[model samples]
Target: MGCGRPFDEVIAIAPLQRCHVMLSWCYLLLSATMTIECLDLSECQAALGMESGAIAAQDILASSSFDEASVGPQYARIRTDVAGGAWCPSTQIDQTRYEYLQVNLHRVHVITCVETQGRHGGGHGKEYPTFYMLEYWRPGRTEWQRYKGHHQNVLLKANFDTNTAVKITLDTPIVASKVRFVPFSEHLRTTCMRVELYGCEHKEGLLAYSMPSGEFYAGHLFDDRSYDGSRNSSGFLTGGLGQLMDGRTGGEFALGNGIVSDAANAEQWVGWTKPLVEFYFLFDDIRNFTALSLHVMDSSNSIKEAAVSFSLDGRHFSHTLVEYFRYENSSVAPGPDWLSIRIPKQCGRFVLVNIRNTGKLLLISEVRFESGDAYDVEIVTDGPFVGRISSPSFEYVWLITGLLGCCFLCALLVTIIAIRQRQRKVTSPSYTGLKSTPQAEHIAVDLKTGQMKVIRDTELWLPFLNAKANSTNVYMFDSDKCAVSKILEAPANVSSVQPAESASTTPLIPLKSSSSEEDSHCLSRKELFFENMRSEYDNPSLHYAASDVRIVPLSKAER
Candidate 1:
C-alpha cells in the first residue's frame, strides 16, 4: 500500500492516499456492473424452439406417408417424434415432384427463416433434397402461393447429405398460418424431408386490402407492380395485400436484391390521377387501433392532407379523425411506417384511410399501423371463428315444442274432415247411379207405433221408385213387412189404409233430441225456430251413419 509514498512525508498525504484507494475500488465495481448489463439473451437467440420440440406433433402434416405405422405425418416433429427417424412419402423416388411436408403454425406468424433436414435412419438413409421450394397460405384465402424473394427465386438450397440441418433466412419475411416444403432434384431419386419454421407472433394483424387502382401516365405505368390482387371492371384492386404493406418505402429509386434497377422509378408507390384515394384494410384478427403511418412521395408536392377511421364490421365505421399529420412528429422508424397520424381510440378489425390530394396526381408508398391485440376493455358477442350447435336454453325449447304440438293437432283435424267428405260423396244418391230431376225429389218413408206408411208426397212415385227409395231405407223396418205391394204404383192421398200390426215401426233418429231449451231466443237468433231448424239430411254433403228403409203391403194370405 506504501509502495510509492515517502516514509516521513506519508503522514502529510495520508488522506489523499486513502481517497485514491477508494476510487480504485469504485472503478472495479463500475466495470463489473457494465459487464453484467451488456449480457442480454436476445442477441444470441437462434432458432424459434423447433430443435427443442416445442411444436406439437399434430400441427405437422405431409402430403403422403410411406408407412403409417412408422413414417406418418404426426411423426414429423423436428427431433422428438422420430418414429422412423423422419417423415418419408409413400412413393420414395425417382420421378415425381408433388410430394411435400406441411406445417400449420395454428395462427398467423411473422416467419423469419425456415430450417430443413432429411431422414437419418442411422447410416442406412443417405437421401436428402438438394433444393426445395416453399409455399405459404394465410386465412381468408383459398390458394397457396409459392414464395419468391427479391430476386424472384423459388428453389432454396437445402442439404448435401442427411442429418445436416440447413438454415435459410428469408429476405422478405412471410406472415402466414401454413407453409409447405416441396423437395426437388435434377435427375431422379426418392425425396423425403423433416422441417422446422422459425418466427414470432404476427403483430401487424393485417389480412388484406382493397383500394383504387394505380394510374397510367404518359408512357409509364405508375401501378403497384408487385401487388398480388386483382383489378375489378371498375379499375379497383381488391382482396390482396401488396407493396403498400410490404415494409418498403418508395421514392425515386427502384431496388431489387440490394441493386438499383432505376433511378427515377416509383413502382413501389400506387398512384392515381384523382385528387383523393380511398384504402380499406382488413385485419387477420381484432385490434385496438392507436394511430396510423402513411408514407407518401410526390415530387410535385401535391399532397395536402389525410384522415383515418375504423370499424368493427366492414360496413360500419367510426367518425373520421382529420388531417393531424402535421401535428404529430414525423421522426418515425424508417421502415413499416413513416408519417404518423393519430387515430381515434377504438377497437375493430377494419381500417379506412382517406388521403386528400390537393393536386391532380397522387402517390402513396406504404401504410403501416400502430395497434395491439390486447384491448383495455372489451365485450365480444362473437369470436374470430363461428360454428352452429343445438340450442341450450329451455326457454326456446318450450316455444318450439308448443309450435310443433299445434301443427300436429291441426293436421289431425284436417285429415278427419277429408275422410268425412269422401264418405258423403260415396254414399250420395247421385253416386249410387240414381237419377232425379231438379224438381223431382226422392221419396221418403216414416213409421211409428207398429204402423208404417208411404210419404204423402211420394205416393205418386212408380212401384220401382218406391222399391228403390225403400231399399235405401230398408233397415228402418223388419224383414217380415219389407214385401212390396202387388199394386205397381201407389195412389196419392190414400190415408184410409191401415198399417200391419207385426212391424215394430219405431221412427229412426240420428242423435238424441233435447226435451227443453234454455231459451227459444237462442233458436230464433240462429234461425233454428220450428221449420227453420237444419238437419243432416238437408245437406247432402254431410255424412251420418244411417239405416236403409223397407216397405211392405197390408194384404195377408187370408185375403
Candidate 2:
C-alpha cells in the first residue's frame, strides 16, 4: 500500500487543535464572569474608596398624620355628614394595612430627592395631609437595619393640586444594600411618587500652607521708648524680623543687641505672642549645633521666680533657671547674661526655640542658636539696670504678730471685765442679809436684889425657867451686894430675914403676896418683861434679892 497520509491522521490533528481552542475560550469566559461578581462598589461609595471624592447621602424614613386611617392599605374615604369629614367604616378597615416598597443596591453614593403626595377630599376643615418615609439596610455581613427620616412639618396640603419634595445631604458615608419607605397612617391618602440617587467619590486631604503675621519678618520689633518705632526705642514685629506684619512669610528669628556689653549695659528685644510663641532659626546648612543662647533680662525684677522654658515645636517645652547678679563697686561677676542651653541633635530646615517667661518681665535682648564648634553667642538685655528705691513693707511675721497682739488685748479686756462683774455681784446689798454677824454681850441687874448676872448669846428668849432642886443652889441677888444673900439661898428651905433696924443697910427682898394668886401662880411681870426683851439684845443678865428666895410646890407655881 502507498504511504499516503491516512484521512484519520489528518482529521485527528484538526480535531485536537479545535478542542484546544474551545477549552481556551471556556477558561476566559469563566474568569470574566467571576471578576464581574467579585468586584465591590461599596468601597468606592464609602470612606474606604480608592478615589478621593465620595460623600454620603441622608436617609429619611417615616412620618405621621393626626387624622385616623390616613396612610395604610385601608385607604380613607370621606363622609359628607361630618364637619371635618369622617373616614368611612369600610375605609377604616384598610387603615391597619401598609403599602411598602423596597430597593436592593450594592452601594449608595447619594440620595437625590424624595417626593410625596396626600389626598385632600375633606372640605376646608382638613387643611393639610402628612406622610413619612423609611430607609433600611444590611451593613457588611450583618442583618437588616432600619432608620426613620421625617421632616418636622408635614408635606402635603389639603385641596392643593401639588406634591412636596424633600432634599437631604448626609454628613457621613454609608454602605448598604437595601432601603425602604413607610407611611405613618393608612387612610389620609398619601403616596411617594419617586426617589432618586447619584453616585459620588471621595475628597482629598487639605492643602498645607504657612500662616502669616501682619508684621515684618519672623521676629517682632518692639520700641521701648515710644508708641511707634521712630519715637519709642522699641516696637513689635509679629513674624520674625524681616517679613511684614500683614502678609504670610516663612523666615527665621534673628535677635541682635545694638551694643555688646556685660550685664550692666545690655539692650533687650522682647517678642510676645498669644499663649504659644514660636521662634525658628534657619541655618545655612547642617552643622554640629550644640548650645542655644538667649540674652534675657527682666525689667520688672519680678522675673526671678519666673520659669524659663525652651522648646522645639513650640508645643512642648523644657525649663531652665535665670541667674541674678549684683555688681559691687563696678566689679562684675560671672553671672548668666546669656542663657546657654544644650541642643541634642541638628533639626531640619530650621530649629524652633520657644521661650516662655513665667516670670514678671518677659523682656529679651537677643537669642542665639549657635553651633557648638563655632562658639556663636547671642546677648539680650532690657537696657541698663535702673535702680529704684522700694518703700518699707510689712513682712508676714509682722502681720501675724499684730494679729496676735490684737487678740491678746481683747482676751485681757474680757478677763478684766469678768473679774469686775464677779466682784460687784458679791458686794451687792441684796446678799447682805445672808451673811453672819458677830454677837454682842449685854448685862442685866436686878435693882431690888442688887444682883448681877451674865446672859448667854441670845436673839430671842422664852419665859419661865425650871430647874430641879440641888445642893448648889441658884441665887437671885442685887447687882452689887448680893454675895451674902446668895450663900444663904444655896440650901433648900433656908430663909434669911433682915433686922428691922438694918433693913436699909441690907438689901430687902420682895416676897410673893399671898393675896395675889396671879403673881404666885405665873411668871412675874419682871420675868415676862426680861423674856420679851431678850430678842432685842445679844446677851442679857438679871439680878434679884437672894432674901426673896423660897421653896414652893411645882404644882402650885404652875397653876
- Specify the highest-TM-score model's number: 1
Evaluate all candidate structures by whole-model CA lDDT and list the values in order.
Answer: 0.55, 0.30
TM-score of each: 0.50, 0.21
List, in order, the clash count of every candidate structure. 7, 75
Residues 1-559, candidate 2, lDDT per residue (tens digit)? 0012221221222221123353354333332311001112243332221112121211222232234344322222121122223222122112454544344444432222233333333323322224444454432122333332112232222223322323333212222345554444446553322233333321110001111122222333332211111111222221112211111111223234532233222212333433334443322222234344445443223122222233223333323322222223322222224444544323222344444434332444444443321122332222343222222235645877899999999999999999999999888744132222232223333434334343342232112111232322332323333211222222223344222221111222222212333323332333212222222222212122232433222223232
lDDT of 1 by residue, 439-491 (tens): 32332332222233333344443432434433222122222233222221121
Runs in model 1 deviating more than 4 A are: 1-48, 74-83, 92-96, 150-153, 213-229, 233-235, 248-274, 298-302, 324-337, 358-365, 377-559
* Consecutive 10-residue window with the lowest summed lDDT within model 1: 33-42
Best by lDDT: 1
